[model samples]
Target: MRSSVPGTAKKFPLHPGHPERICWGCDKYCPASDMACGNGSSRTQHPAEIFGDDWFEPDPGADDAGAGREG
Candidate 1:
């Protein structure tokens, strides 16, 4: 039987990571491995904690990113 819920698959995408979004399933920082939804989901304070927005990509060393003077 078809589900009444709209976008049923969207509610819980099978892969759990194709959209490159923070996995709501594992709640951990990952590149969309094989995350599965369960009672083991964890929570972090910052977005970087999950994706590490700073550590992974260090300063690009450019005028825009490494600009010392304010213009």
Candidate 2:
């Protein structure tokens, strides 16, 4: 199924070659200098920048099986 909102269905790159050159704030993928969202003065940094190269990888310590479940 496709997303109802525009640009929301686009596949985001897990490891963009130049993450800093583009704005990760929205699906527009606008250049860092030109943010289409107009929500902030500065461009949002890609997750890879703050979380490192393994940003998409699951955390080994996270207990996925127990998430949202009560004992």
Candidate 3:
């Protein structure tokens, strides 16, 4: 059998396993299956998300690589 409290919101369990990750940019709660900005902080959120690889270090080589690959 199941149990419930009077007038309380229905409480349901998530999946078997999951992680609660919040999006620093949107301030929305994201699940494990979702993606979270690696460099989330008070300084910037979108910057880290838009530029994942270069978030740590602004590599000049990245720009040159893109320029060379362009048609």
Candidate 4:
């Protein structure tokens, strides 16, 4: 059965290293290179795997570094 709630898949970047292989269907992290959830029904896929390494790039001119903030 399809879920009525819109589900957002957790995105794992490859830059930091050792991106975990987690099941988007559930909360368990499957590291065995196999589907460990839903009896091989849901496929596990990372954001970088589908959209390339720069998939999660920051917004342009967003000023996220707190450039003018005082201590």
- Tell me, by lDDT, which candidate is best: 2
* Candidate 1 positional error at 25, Å: 5.8
- Candidate 2 regions exceeding 4 Å error are 1-8, 64-71
| Clash-forming residue pairs, model 2 | none
List the lowest-lDDT window of 10 residues for candidate 4.
Answer: 9-18
Question: Residues 3-48, candidate 1, lDDT per residue (tens digit)?
Answer: 4676563332333323454444433343344445442444222335
Task: Indicate the residue-level lDDT of 12 in model 3.
Answer: 32
lDDT (tens digit, per residue) of candidate 4 on 1-71: 33355684444334534444554445465653676665476556666666767768875667867778898
- TM-score, each model? 0.19, 0.73, 0.21, 0.39
As for lDDT, the candidate ahead, 1 or 2, is 2
Show the colliding residue pairs in model 4. none
For candidate 3, the lDDT comes to 0.42
Supply the TM-score for candidate 1. 0.19
Model 3 over residues 1-71: C-alpha lDDT tens digits?
13376655433333212223333334333343464644343323334445553465767777677665646
Q: What overall lDDT, based on C-alpha atoms, would model 4 receive against the true structure? A: 0.57
Residue clash pairs of candidate 1 = none
CA deviation > 4 Å runs, candidate 4 = 1-24, 32-34, 39-42, 59-71
Give the C-alpha lDDT of model 1: 0.43
**lDDT tens readout by residue for model 2, 1-71:** 35667766677789999999988887678899878888589888999999999989998868786788888
| 39: Cα error in model 4, Å | 6.8
